[model samples]
Target: MNAIADEAIYSFGIDIGGTFTDVILHRGSDGQSISTKVLTTHLDPREGAIIGVRQLLEQWPIPPRQVGRVVHATTLFTNALIERKGVPTALVTTAGFADSLEIGTERKFDLYDINIEKPAPLVPRELRFEVEERLNARGEVVTALSQETLAAVVARLVEQRIESVAVVFLHSYLNPVHERLAAEYIRKHAPGVHVTTSYDVAPEIREYERTSTTTACAFVKPLAEGYLRGLQNNLRELNIGAPMFLMLSNGGLTHLEEVLKNPIQMLESGPAAGALSSAFFGKLDGYPDLLGFDMGGTTAKLCLVEQGAPMLAYAFEAGRTKRFMEGSGLPIKISTVELIEIGAGGGSIARANSLGLLNVGPDSAGSEPGPVCYGRGGDQPTVTDANLQLGYLNPDFFAGGSMQIDAPLAGHAIGRLADQLGLSLVKAASGIHILVSEAMASAARVHIAEHGRDPRHYSLLLTGGGGPVHGYCVGRKLGVKRLICPPSPGVASAWGLLVAPVKIDRVRTLQTTVQDGDLQAVEQSFLELEQEARGVVQESAVQHQKTFVKRLAEGRYKGQGFSLIVPVPDAALGNEQGRQALIEAFENEYRRKFSRAPSNLKIELVAIRLSVHTEDLIEEGLQFPSRSGALAAVKQVRKAWFEETGGYVDTTVYNRDLLGSGDTFNGPALVEDAGSTLVVGPNATCSVTAHGSIIIELH
Candidate 1:
């Protein structure tokens, strides 16, 4: 059949990681789930994705048209920025302020360091031309944009042969007349070049972030669009004519058309999926606070989840030279799920530095060369090699025996590292393991401290292939006593896409003082904002189950440098009581933040935010019945290294599929699955939950 018009309802979620292409196919009618992990084709991620989807569909017996939806997350744009591989882009801004991206906030993330490096601007100085126009903070055009000014800018762009152009006039977030005029002119004059404006991409406060975000969007617009269109056409050719969706960095799904125009929103889309999975699973288990730990082949991401919601921030940085510090990269004024990522994963390379000291990564081998054990022509020692040498991995059972790992090659690689360190192979392997663990802990500590969260109150949920292998040590360093490992943790990120809702978040700057501002004006502004946001959602062709809206305001003292978000009740905000209620809400939130609120200071409302989204598009169904099979066939013993014991130990190894509900055991133990391994550290107790996940208690 060319199409299955009356077939069962099924959906697919795809995530492209550095080393693997993870796919999760699920039946919406009954919650049947099938997952697969295949090595990533770095040259063309779509090649690996098609293979995985084809294999999954063949095995699960789902019809092509029965796959109603496909949600995707990829690292293409982020990697392009880091590697400086985007299209040739130019920037056009207000004449006097064209260099705002370089000026930044002028505050060094490391104040005492004299030689801190910042990533070069996406639009270099020579290519950043300026139009002679000005707009005051209130959006008043001081010097109205003229035709002559537009013509000159277009001439320069055409002469330089810029592939794309970004227009970022000052105060465009408040009013966009000038920016729109400039963008329209460039579009008409430069027929073949693409255009992006700050008003369309990031209509928010802060000039530097807006410019940076717009520039980034312009830089990747051409390349990302071509890649996505190629994949979409390929899928259509396969008789899978489903509407494709792309994941946003805010843990929501939007149509591919939206992402192609605003590529900056996809910078952290892959990592955000893991955080969303964390929040969903945490809510199901009655956990209000948790720490998400996800380590794949290239990196480890840590996010703080509170009250079933992952933390969110408007300001984000990408491609940082200093991984732990801010202000070392380009700032994007886009709302997104907040998380910290570091280079500490299975494929992280190990090297002896010029100082002759052992150094683990901030660099990864990725999928092309992978690790020494993968036998993919890699000669360098990596974390995977260390794990194999320490007996944490099984050589023959890797990738469910589909791919074989060479243990001898791994040992040889580790032996070279051991020789340089002047230590035994096991000792060097232990050092590599511990150093990466410490690096992960350092990233988590900085991330949590910045968010003002205490680690003792949060349990660590380990996802990704590399997370559980190092979770015990990292958790202990962060004072986390409880760890939860979900079933098929490595594929959780992809599964998150199947549950994501179609969402659109919009923000507009409206500077108003609470003491003297009109409540009627506040009520009117929010209504306009809600309508605008709703229009965007309604434009999409996807049919949502339910729809709703949430109104929020960013508030702070008149002289404060930062602002806090507070919820506003729609009905109460139209009268005197609503104004009173808003002030009280601000006071309550302020006291919660600073332990007290100043009664004398004036509270100024900075911005209005609107979040419009559909209700849970998919039903909650991660739970699975415990298996009734015997464990004797899957149970075995292996030699595993344990730092607590200061040597190798006989660790019990069990198959994850054979462990049923109510099954309990004590570590040292290793639980194997098709795609990942869960390590139960010494002195910990593990139990299988009703959902077939593992819960470990160290105290």
Candidate 2:
């Protein structure tokens, strides 16, 4: 294939997930988009991504030179930490703080459990070395860094063949001079070793969180560098001369260099992109406030989107021993889209527990073996197998007929679990399906309630490979009346990467009372943060594109250990009016959360944050293309099981591509698309929107 017209340009978005690699292409000449999905290559994720990209471009026949931009998001770093596949790393901390990771805030996620297991530290004790350096809370040096001790630590690290090191000095967020000096010495002596400092990764007051965040960055630094550079080189070799932008956990995009420095920032990159995609499609479909339900092969994630933006969180846990427990995972302080994730997906393993109760999963078969229906050597019963057994999935139409699925194999796999549970095949399959739906609904309820939102008020927008398949039952459980399945729901995350803005978030610790404090210093600190954030954004921003900045402050009452984030006033904070505005904002937010504010308590500002991002590049109200033919919508009829219908009933199956705008259909129908399938329950009214989205309305 030859290159398109020189004037026309194209952009590619690639998302490497746990089970699949999604690649999407968008043309600048027209609002055309296409996507493809391939099984993830667990050995080297880059290989799967490259293959998907090559296949997409070949199918669409777009030349490489015309590709102007490449945006990517991946779960590689997160998986590395979870699987302990990262290189050997070391930690250098101030004296007497070597056990900080072991003694993490002295808080237990489950207090009543006699034997609670905590996430282990990435670096073992032998790999953790301490140096003689100290700084007080006021940023004053208490004990100077011992040069001989630091040199010896560096020598020990080199001797141990540590490829990466995390240097976290006490109070380094306030005074990083000692940490910087140690890093400089290490780089000079062992130039091959990578160094990460707490101040650079997470400059906050919490000792344990800062150290954990830095250690995570260091642990994945070498692996991230190699994979990213190799992917870039391979793209160039394909004659695609575009600059690649990486997706950040905070629902933004950054340059390769920025993420290589702190790979932890990409920990939630894939899920964040999925959330952003939901928000983007929801707004276009006239539902700005909705809940994003993304159920891929490995897990299900739910995020709250309000006013066309998904909520942002400052910190999130990674590699949790307990999926829903907060402190059961490593605490990493990085900005990310707020969401709750549960282990309920198509590939989630299903089995009878010791108590003779059926349990779905926190474990998935992934794409390597996949579900039994894929004929990938999988012997375990999974949600996909159960769905197939229930007639919810068309074996021949799986993955748009790109791959053949064996229905008998799926039934045989589920038959074992059915026998153990002493239930019929159909009954057992229904149990598995309902169990996963209930789990997702339970998690979503808590997540929404935590944000003081009512599930009935928010429309549920479903995406990912499994979302549409299970969305109806999940939404019904949550008492949600409406659900939306956007076009190409399976590869939405890749499309999200293309629309994400170039963003940078910066923070600084500034302890001060709203009533009496150094206002000038606070203002100066914000200015500095904004300047730094904007500089980073410019590295990835388009030439001459306008940028926007949002100022936020983390504040708390006088004696509180936790803080809440509130928007800071746009006016100058050096004046009394600005201070009053800040206080009012904090109080307003407090009232919303707690229903009232204390009358006689002082407000303390813990930190200030600045976020800079380029303006949205995609136009609003853009609609996806519809089918060009007048072909009949109903492709076939299949006997499908539905609780509402009691037993197997002949259900009309419709091809999603043939359903044009305003096409209306009733329940007990299956809308089949190339990427995913949407199941409409009995009595529910399904309609096609102008943009090719399937909207199911249930009373």
Reference-based TM-score of each model: 0.96, 0.97
Which digits, one per residue and each the tens of the lDDT, describe model 1 over residues 307-421? 9878887778888888767788888877788998988889999989988889999788888888988999999999989988887888877867768899999899999988998
Residue-pair clashes per prediction, in order, are: 0, 0
Kindly state the number of residue pairs that clash in model 1.
0
What lDDT is reached at residue 23 by model 1? 91
Give the 10-residue window scoring lowest on summed lDDT in candidate 1: 1-10
The whole-model C-alpha lDDT of candidate 2 against the native structure comes to 0.89
Report the lDDT of model 2 for residue 29. Answer: 71
lDDT of 2 at 560: 98
lDDT of each: 0.84, 0.89
Question: What is candidate 2's lDDT per residue for 353-442, written digit by digit as tens?
Answer: 998889999799999899998999999999999888877788888877878899898899899999999989888899999999999999
Best by TM-score: 2
